[model samples]
Structure formats: C-alpha cells, structure tokens
Target: MEYSIEDVAAARSLQFAKYMYTSMATFWTYDYACSLHEEWTFLLRSHWSKMKGLYIATRYLPFILLITNLYMSFTPNENLVKCGMLVNITSGLGMILAICADCFFIIRTYVFWNKNKILLAAIVGTYLSFVVASVSIIVDTTASAAYATIPIPDITGCYQSSTSDQIFIPFVLFSVFGLGLMILTLIRAIHSWQRNQSHLYVVLMNHNILYYACVFLFSVMNIFTSLLLQDSYQTVLDGVQFLALAIIATRMHIHLWQTNQHLRGSSGLVHIRLSDMSSVNVTA
Candidate 1:
C-alpha cells in the first residue's frame, strides 16, 4: 500500500521521536546505574533534611516520567483523549521536575554567597517571579496542546496535532533564569577565588561553573527547537534536557556533601556546609 507525502512525513517524525525515546532510556539507565553506589553511600546514609527531600524528589521523579513517556511513545494507544491527557501529565510533571532541579541552584548559590540576606533576597525574588510567570504560561499553553489519532502507515502512536507557540515562553524564561544564576555565580566565584584559594573552594567553583554551562547550553537548544519545530520534533530535547538537569544537580549536591565530610574544609569553604546550604530563609 502507498501513502501520501504528508503521511510519510508524519511516519518519519514519529519514527524520529521513537529514536529520541530510545536514546533517553539508554542514557537514563546508564546514569542511574552508575550513581546507585553514590546514592546509597552519600544519600541513604545521611540524616534527613528538607534539602534531602528536595534532592530525592529531583533525583527520582524523572524515573516516573521516563516510564510514562515510554508508554506514550512505544505502547499501542490510539485514543486521542488519553494521548492528550498523558501529554498534560508529562508536561506538568516536567515543569515540576524543572523547578525541583532548579532549587539546587538556588540553594547552592545562596550558600556560595555565604548566605548573605541581600544576595539571597535578590536571587529568590527573581526566581519566584520566574516561577510565577512560567507557571501561568505553561498552564495556559499546555491546555492548548491538541492531539489526534494517527491513522497513517507505520505510525503506532497518536500524533500531536497542535501545540502552542507560547509553550516556548517557559523555555525562554528558564534560559534567562539560568543565565542570571550563572552570572551571579561567576561574580561570586571571583570573590571566592580571592578570599581563599583552597582545594575545596576550587572544586566547588568548578562544579558550579561547568554544570551551569552544560544546563545553559541545553536550555538554549531547547528554546530554539521548541520555537522552530512543530509536532514531535518540537520536544525532541525535552527528555535529554530534563535528565541533564537532574543528573547534574544531584551530582552537585552529592559531591559537595562528600567533600565537606572528607575534607572538613578550610575557613573559606567550611562555612558553606551541605546541610546549611538549603536553609536559606526566603521569607526573610
């Protein structure tokens, strides 16, 4: 049997999305496996705290999402309503996952600034603004996502008939937020360098800068793809981006905890203990 050009394109796009899911599953498996020992030793053995709760959520929520997304892409489902509902569920979860990952930056930066109230206020204010705006935009745009049953050759999943261009706004907001965080971190990084040139200080600085750079790059890539592409292609980077944020953020927390425990740090670095990092009083 023959198919129309549009049908062929749709099939190819769905195929590409399947490839994306395959890659995400592969990466997630490898990343989670490699970190299991660290998680058991550093996280499971540690005392509980609100910060630990956030880290656990950030680390594990994506595993739930990965399962759902796999079901969406690979499983045989033709109900448009179910497809739309799954999309909404995943999108909302992804937004929440993003905030969870971002909290690490907020907490770490607050600690990096030596828990200065003024700097903490500045960062928290900007972050809350971004959060409010992104929540409003994502809620509005997610409602606009429409799906249809794909009746074409070689396609097993429902096709995303339409998604709002405004969906890109959240990515844009996040990119801006990430850039600001990186800027603040770099500025403070200079002060840290001059204040105390300890090995612990160098390690912390290296982790922040390098990981922030990676997250920032992926954010930009997401913005462009979400803005320019349509249908399945629009979200090709979504899984990888989320995984990047999760893996990098968790690594930052774990490495810091281990460093603090082992080195006990010089005067410069010891003040920023892992337990105290997330105790920033945003209300004050």
Candidate 2:
C-alpha cells in the first residue's frame, strides 16, 4: 500500500517526538545518578535506620526503572508485550517510593506533634486509605498490557497499556497528602515560633515546606499530563516526572539527616565556670 504525503509527515513527527522524549529521560536519569553518587557515602555509612533504608530504596528503585524503561524504549517491537510488564514493574516501584517518601514527612509531622498517639493514628488511617485506593487502581491497570505502534521499525516505546483512565488517581492522592502535611507543619511551626522563637524550628519549617512544594508540583504536573494529554507521549513524560520526584525526595532525606548531625554537634558543646580564681572554660 502507498501512503500519502500527510501520513509520511505525521509518522516523521511522531518519530521525532519519541526521540525527544527519550533524550530528556536520559538527561534527567544522568542527573539523578550524579546525585546518588554525591550522597553515596552518607547513604552507605550512616547509622542503619529505617529512614535511611527507605531513602536508599527511593533513590535506587526509580533509577533501575529508568534504565529498564529506556532499554525497552530502544528494543524491538517483538518484545513490546514484555515492555508492558516492565511498565507495571516501574509503576509498582514508583508507588513504593512515593509511599516511602511520604512516610518520611509523616514521621516528621508526628515528631512535630510531640508523638501524639491520637494524631498519629488519625494520620496513619488516612494515609492507609489513600494507599489502598491507589494500589487498587495500580493493580487493575497493570493486570493487562497494552501496546502502541512505533512510527519507526524496531523501537519499543510504551503505550498507555492500562485500559483504565484513572491512572492519575495515585498522583492526586500524593498531592493531597503533601498539601495536608505542609499545612499541619506550617501551623505547628507558627505556633512553636510564637511560643519560643527557636532557630531550629525556623530551619525545620523552611526545609519541610520547600520539600513539600517541590514534590507537590511534580505530582500535579504528572496528573495534568496523564489526564489531559493521554494520547500523546505521556508515558515517557510521566516516567521522567516519577524519576524526578524520587530524586528530590531522596535528596531531602539526606539533607535532613546532615542538618540534624550539624545541629547535634553544635548542641554538644559544654560551658564550665570556676568560682575560685578567674577562669571560664567552654568546650564542644
């Protein structure tokens, strides 16, 4: 069959778009790798804590997904069905990272609230409800794989495989939770500052607010692109955004830990006064 000029132009355009998307994903993934390298020592040598473990997973899992997805994008169409499974795995890893990152904020907020059991229980219940709904959506969408036609032969880019249109639900939930946490933190920070103007509280509030804003913006963009431009190259764009969110969350965790270490070291100083002669000693 002979194709028309318009058809040829459209195919070329689609091919261009695919290449552009892959380029952007590659660049961002490289940047993410650089960040992970910079923080490798802290991540490897820090006291083994649950938060540290979560940070490591949040950094590595999305990275692995990014690499796998890129490989799938460049592979032949014969393996497209396998690409669907890769997409599902990527989605699962993204969800896990999101939950872990949010849990970091939840723990921070709980500590800010002085570990109130009632508030902790309430927050946990709300978070779990969202998780259940989000997971259900993910499971339903990933159960079946969908394939897209590649404009260029031998390229295995992903198509919106899940027949479900509610793929944006989890991202929306993430934004909602983030906004709620930011508000709670803001309120607590303001109250505490009014009571006792502490520099530490100021720093904590600033860091939390900045981190929340960054992740919230990413989530919102992901939802918008997933819902509004579903027919376009949304899959690749969404993957990039998820990778970015993971990188940001992991960096925030490391920054928080380093800040706390600095604070602790500063707090360890001691001052001694001798009443006898004329000497005052201060040591850290």
Candidate 3:
C-alpha cells in the first residue's frame, strides 16, 4: 500500500495530537495522586519559604502551560499560529519553570555547603547571567522572525512557523547549570561522608545526583532531538521534558520535607538547614 503526502501529514498531525493529550492526562493523574497522598497536607501547610514558594510555582506552572498548549493544539485558530503571543508566553513560562527548578538545586547546594554566603552569591550571579542571556535570545528571535501558521488539516490545529534552533541556546545553558550543580552536590556529599561517615549524607548525595542527572539528560536530549530531527515529534518531546522537569522538582521538594519530618519525629530534633551543613539532617 502507498500513502500520499497528505496522508502522511495527517498521520503525523494525528500522532502529535494523541501524544499531547496523553501527556496532559498523565500530568493530571500524577498531580491528583500526589494530592491524595498523606504528604499533601504537609506540602500545603509547610512554612512558605522562598524555596518553598518557588517549588509551588514550579508545580503549578507546567499544568497551566500544558492546558494552554492543549487548547492551542485543538482550537483551529489560524491567527493563533501567526500571533507569536502564544509562542512567547509558552517560552517564557518554560524559562520560569527552568529557573525555579535550578533555584531549588542552587539552594540545596548552598545548604550542603553550610550556607556559605560567598558561594551563594556566586551561584546566584551565574544564574542571573544565564537568565539575561536566555531572555535576550528569546526577545531577539521573536522580534525578528515573521511567524506564520502551518495548518494541519487532519487535526484541525496549527503550529507556529519557527525553527528548532531557538531551543538550543537556552537548553545548553540549562544543561551546563545542571551539570555544575550536580558536581557541586557530589563534592559536598563526598566531603561530608568522609568527615562523618553518615548514611544520611549518602542518601542526600545519591538523591541530588540522580535528580540532577535525569534532568540534565532530558535537557541534552531535547537539544539533540530538536537539532537532529527537526520534526513535529520534537514538539512532543519538548512538552514531555517540560512536564518532567516540573514533576521531578516538585517531587524532590516534597520528598525532602517528608524526610525531614520523619527525622524530626524519630530523633526529637531537626538539624537540617536549607542553607547550612551542620549535620546529617536533610536536603530536598
């Protein structure tokens, strides 16, 4: 059997649509399950520190983006494709989520390092530089490009006409930051372990390493797939990566809180500081 060009395009659009819905559904289900868990009250009633606020933002932002993207996927609005507003909004939201997730790591690193003010300042400075560079790229690219609609007849949706190259810069910056944080965490964990030989430090070290590694891998793959394939499917991967980052960061935060609560209950004291390394407490 032979398929025509139109058939292929339709099939591709249909596949993309299916993937978007599936991913959105998965995010909602995971979020709902989290709410049902006993930790939900803890997450809500916990002290609203800066890090906690950022974590909460990360948790909700992706769901908002997913909902908007899903609507755009099926809205059949020709103008939505060319307006560039949606693209800008989506990109901005993604950047914000990335920043929040990275902030969580930075704070963790700072705490692991015993809340060194100098180290915290240096990390924040570096993070700010990346933010400026990313925003500059986004603004320049969006301003210069003439966005148009690529209508998919089969799916009744339209995609913005933009090259995947725009994603590379931000992703590369994020990947570098992630790798640096992972290294910092590993170093601190090792140092703490050598000093005290505590199992808690090992757990802290392992969790940070694993989360950073997973997120870094996702960032790298997003860049690779966008650069190499340059297809509609790449958009699906982008959605997945964004949602994954949000979920993982939020889960890490909740896990840390739960672990800290457990330690406090069992040991009669919580020595954990979000910006200091005094003992084997916790790092979320």
Candidate 4:
C-alpha cells in the first residue's frame, strides 16, 4: 500500500508536533527544577497575598498539566474515548491556567497604572467577555469534535485529531484580546518611564514588555498552527505561550519582591504603597 503525499505530510506534521510538545515540556520541567530554590525561599515561606493563588497556579500547575499531556501524546491509541477525554481535560485546564496568567498580568498592569478604576473596569470588562466567549467556543468545539485515529502511519494520536475548524475561533479571539492588553500596557509604560526613570520603574517596564512580547509571538504562532497545520494536535503552542508567560511574569514578581525587601520602605514594585505590601508578596 502506497501512501499519498498528503498522508505522509499529515503523519510527519503530527510527529513533529509531538516532538515539539515533548521538548517544551522538558524545557519547562528543567526550568521548574532550577527555580525550586526561589520558589521555596520567596513564594513558599512568604506570607500570602491576594495574588498568591494566581502566582501558584501560574507557577506550578503546569507541571501537572504537562505530565498529563505527555501521557496523552505517548499513550497507545487503543481507546479513542479515553484519548478524547484526556485531550479535552488538558485543553480546558490549559486554557484556565492561561486565563489565570492573563488575570495575573491584569493585576500587575492595574497596579502599575496606580489602580486606575477606569482602566481596570475597561480592561477587566473586555477580558471577562473574552473569557466567556473563549470558554464557550472551546467547549462547543471539543464536544463536537470528530475524534479519529488518523489512518496515516506514524500518527498514533489520542484524539490527536483534526478538530472542527471552528476551533480556531478561540485562538483568534485570544490573539485579539492579548493585542488590546498590549496596547494599554505600552501607552502607560511609556508615560511611566518618562515621568520617573527610577531603577525599579525601569525594571517593572522591562518585565512587562517581556510578557507582552512573549504573548504576541506565541499568540500569533498559536493562531497560525490552529488554522493551517494539519496535525495541530493539542492546539500546539498555546501551552508554550502560557509557560513562557508564567516563567517571565512569576520571575518578575519574585525579583520585585526581593527588590522591595532590599529597599526597606519604598513601594517601587508597581508603585503600590500600602503597609501590607511591605511584608507580603503581592506583586502579581
């Protein structure tokens, strides 16, 4: 039996996706190992704050989800139903974790802008709407997915499948939402830098820029992969995007916490000058 070019391409694409996800998982695991000291010393021992829950979710939840993904990617495709369940579970959790990361960014952004209620209301409102739309679209798509074990050789995937093209809607929506956040962050970041080019302010600006840059790059990659790639199993780089953001954002908060502690009294991190912020880790 000879395989056509399309079959071969699809099989190869699926294989490549599996490899990419595995590599990403490995890289994140290694990063987690390296950050254990910081996690224990800074986040674990410190008193909790409102943002602490988000911090933990963004920081450690990936390990659990990444492990689940590895099982889905490598497991035999004997039971399509089981595979489908895994796919849906991981995808949904990944979205929620990414949502947590987004909210964490929002908190940081709001504080950076000095807790502007107007800005908070606008951004939060838009983000809430986006979340609702995203969740509905993803759930509907997952429920309606036509899961099948690809006929091509070397494409052993658990519900690692061609989902409804409508699945791309959430990815597109998220890309747009992220773009809006980027615009707001930038406009304010510029003003902040011009007003006072303090070292701490510069650090805050740099880290925020890092998060936006990562979000922009990965969001585009996710949209493209979801739309065009044949074996775009597990929505590919969405996990990568959240992982990158989690690492960057969490590290920023930790560094800022350390800096605030070192400075003794000033609220340089996001400029939140409250008595509680001095003792607790609140830089989400």
Candidate 5:
C-alpha cells in the first residue's frame, strides 16, 4: 500500500468526522430522553386530582426531578445554573411523599395487626431508613449548588465529582431499600390473603403490590440502562419506561372502576332478595 501525505491527512479528517458524528448522536438521544420525561410528566399531571392526593404527589415529584435532570443535561453554564437546587427540591419533595406513604402503610398494618406495636415499630424503622437515605441524597445534591462552579468533565455534562459521588451513593441505597420494601409488602399481602381470603382485599392488595413492583423494577432498569448503555440505548429505555407505566396504570384504573361497579350491583341485588323474602313471609 502506497500512501502520500495527503492520503494520511484525509484519513485523519475522516476519523475526526466519524467521532464528531457519534458524539452528536449521543447528545441527541440524551436530549430525546429528557423530552420524553417531560411528556410523561405532563400526562401524569393532567390526571392529577383524579386519584387521592397521594397519587398526584407521587407522579409529580419524579416528573419534576426529570425536568431538572433534563435542564442539567442541556445547560453548558455549570457555574451559572442553579440545577443542584432543583435536584434538591425534587428529591426533598419525593422523600416527603415516600415518608407519608410509609406512615400510611404503617398505620394500616397496625390496624390490621390489632395494634401490634412491635411489628409497627419494625416496619416504621425500615421506612424511616428509606426516608433518611432519600434525604441524604437531597442534601448531597444540594451541597453542589447548581450555580456553583463545577468541573465539566467531557461531554457528559457539568458535575462536581466529589459531591456527585455522595449523591449517587445514597440514591443507590434508597433504591435498594425501596425494592426490598416492595418485596416485603408483596409477601405480606400474599400471606394475609391465604389466611382469610377476602376476594376484595386480595384484589386490592395484588394491584397495590404490582404497582409498587413495577415502579421499583422499571425505575431501576431505566437507571441502569442510562448509566451503562450508549445514549441511543437511553432513548429506547425512556420510551419503554414511559409506555410501560402508562399502560399498567391505565389498565389498573379501568379494572378498579369495573370492580367497584360490580360490587355495587351485587349489593343491590342482595338487598332486593332480602326484601322479597321478607314480603313473602309477611304475606304468609
């Protein structure tokens, strides 16, 4: 192979062009993920207040964090943007929601247990740890002010490495804790159903378990995909997560409505049957 100086220069230029194209593609996919996040957030917000306030808050908090993450990914002025503050607010609100849910579950479990203080305490303690971990993540993310000067390493965006590590550690811990809690809840529900077998209770409990399980599993998978795969893969993951959540939630909501209607009809029929029986006896 004979190559002139011009040929060497041409090859180098081609390689550079390819590298730039790849980088641009990754950035595009990353931006697309942010857009999807915003889209899903808006959809969920539109449905807010339909369920209890808890549902409204749970959907809102994560969407807000998704927005903050989107902003950080797009912005180049690391020192001028208050992105870290946004993250802090998002995580803090999320932690509050988690704690509230924890309290609600603890109370329900206590009532179901006939005020077993020990079991209640254990469950509460475990959830408290979850809340604490979330709060720690909030604190760490906040420690690195969005407007503060931070080193920008590569095209991945601006982040203070030291503080980010602290933030990530607590985030991982909280996620793990959440997964464990979901599993425990599922097990407890199964046992409760086996003991008494109330159809209504069982149905509700299973729906609740499935909802939490999807939340934990998909959320973890989304995070993992974002961290490990190329940015293109992230776009795919974002799409998958959004569609999965939407489909599952919608289905559950529809089924709940149907179940309620059926129950109401059954109750009415029972009332009519008792009335007819009483009327016949009076006639006799």
Candidate 6:
C-alpha cells in the first residue's frame, strides 16, 4: 500500500530518533573509554590508595552508561527496554564518584588535622550522610515502571530511556559536599601557612579548590540542563560535563606535582640560608 504524508512524517521522526541515539552511543563510548584508560594507567603506576580505587570505579561508569544507551539505540523490543532502564540506573556511578572523592578529602583533612577531633568527625559524618542519600535514590528510581514504559513507534527496534530520573538528592548532596569540603580545606591551608609557611599547603589547597569547584559547577550545570532541556540535548550535555570534569581533575593533578617540586626547591634555599646564618654567628 502507498504511504501518505503523515506516514512519511512518522518515519522521519523515528529515523531522527535513531540517529540521535547513534550519536550518543558514539560520543559516550569514546569519552568513557579514554577515562577508563587514564584511570587504569594511574592506578597501575601510582602507589596503592583509596583515591585510586575511586578513580578506577569512576572510570568504568561512563562505559556502562554508554552500553545502556547503546541498547536503547539498537533495541526495539518493549520488554527489554526495562533492562535498558536498569542500565541507565547505573549512571549513578557519577554520583558515587563524587561521594568517594569527598570521603577521600575528609580522610585527608583528618590526617592533616590530626590534633582536631571535632572537625574530622564532622567531615566524615557529612560524607556518610551523602552516601546514604545517594544510594536511596539509585535504588528507588531504577526499579520503577516510569523508566521502562516510554512508548516507541514500533515493536521491532531498540528502545532506551534517554536519561536518568530527576534524582535531585544526589546532585544536592554532592554540591553541598564539594562546597563544604572546599571551605574547610581553605581554612586548614590558611592555618598551615600561618604556622609554618609550608608551601605544600598552598599547592594542595589550590588543587583541592579547583578540583571540587569543577565538580560543583559541572554537577549544577548537568542538573539544570538535564532537568530543563530536551532529552536529545541531555546526551550532549552529559558528554560535555564529563569532559570538563576530566580536564579539571587532570590539570589539577599536574599543577599539584609541579607546585610540590617548586616548593622543594624553595625549601632547600631556606635551609642553606639558615646554615649560613649559623656559621656566621659561630665565627663572630
């Protein structure tokens, strides 16, 4: 039978949807793969640490998300769409990464402020609360029918949920975590600078500030765009958000290493100056 204008329009919409999914699949795969390689390389080369494990776990999340997006792009079956919905649930990995990094920050704070019990406990307690909230959202949203039942035109192709649920709790949790830890870190660094003028304090504080600032900004932007924009645009926003985070973290890491090296050189000069002063005083 011959098709009419309405049929042609419907066909065009499906084709457009397929193309959109295809683009998402391509970008996320590349973004996550690069992250996976970077995290794995860092884990293997660096000293064993909790932060490294956090990075490794984080590095795998995008890959898993891409897989779910891919399933949606390719699968047309309504029943299996539920399975794809489950995969989208795994995107909470990003939120988990934020929590893990915050925990590491708290531990670092404790180590640096070993003399201060109250501050350390507060940081630890706050991070734990965030972890609890994030877990709740991930569990509840992924299990709902709302995720799996979005209608598709045909029964023959892949259907996927375009995005995760609102899940505002995790975003709010991380934003607070980043902002609070950032302020705490700055205060401790200022205290260290006043007491000993240790350059390590400056270097570390700067890195921490930039790292979490990026996380905080990205989290907010992602939340706004995902909540307000079209589903098609959300995929692009996701990729951009991930890219910004990766760049910020990598740059901060390099900055810290360089700053530490410079500080060591400066410390050597101070030691030499003190040695010369002692000799002059002894000779006089």
lDDT of each: 0.75, 0.66, 0.68, 0.70, 0.46, 0.53
Which ten-residue region of model 6 has the weakest summed lDDT? Answer: 275-284
Tens-place lDDT per residue, model 4, 1-284, is 88777666656656766787799888997987897898788865566766777778878888888887777777666678887798788878788788877776677677677778898899889888878888888788777776656566556656444566666667677778777777777888777566666666566666666777677777778777777766454355766776787788777777866665665556534344322332222332
- Which regions of candidate 5 are displaced past 4 Å? 1-51, 59-81, 94-117, 144-163, 179-183, 186-195, 215-258, 268-284
Ranking by lDDT: 1, 4, 3, 2, 6, 5
Query: Between the candidate structures 4 and 5, which one is better when assessed by lDDT?
Result: 4
- Tell me the tens digit of each residue's lDDT in model 6 across 183-262: 87777777766554545555556667776787688778767866775443444455455544544554344344345445
The clash count for each model shown is 0, 0, 1, 0, 2, 5
TM-score, per-candidate, Cα-based: 0.89, 0.79, 0.84, 0.85, 0.51, 0.63
Q: List RMSD in Å for every model shown.
A: 3.9, 7.6, 3.7, 3.9, 11.7, 8.4
Which residue pairs in model 4 clash with each other?
none
Q: Is candidate 4 or candidate 5 better by TM-score?
A: 4
Top lDDT prediction, candidate number: 1
Question: Candidate 5 lDDT, tens digit per residue, 1-284?
Answer: 56566444433433343344345445545544655554454455333432434434443444443444454444553544454554455446445545444333344344444456787678778767766765765576567533333232233322332223343344355457546656666666666655644444455456656755765776677567645543324433433444345434444544544454465566532111111111101010
Please write out the lDDT profile of model 3 over residues 22-87, one tens digit for every residue.
Answer: 677676677758666654676666775666678668877887777666655665545754446665
Candidate ordering by TM-score (highest first): 1, 4, 3, 2, 6, 5
Model 4, TM vs. native:
0.85
- Judged by whole-model lDDT over C-alpha atoms, candidate 6 comes out at 0.53
- Model 1: residues >4 Å from true position, as ranges? 265-272, 278-284
- In angstroms, the error of model 6 at 60 is 4.5
Who is ahead in TM-score, 2 or 5?
2
- Candidate 5's TM-score reads 0.51
Residue 277 Cα positional deviation in candidate 1, in Å, after optimal superposition: 1.3
Q: Per-residue error at 244 for model 6, in Å? A: 4.3
Between the candidate structures 1 and 6, which one is better when assessed by TM-score?
Answer: 1
lDDT of 2 by residue, 44-86 (tens): 6576656667777776776576676666555554566676787
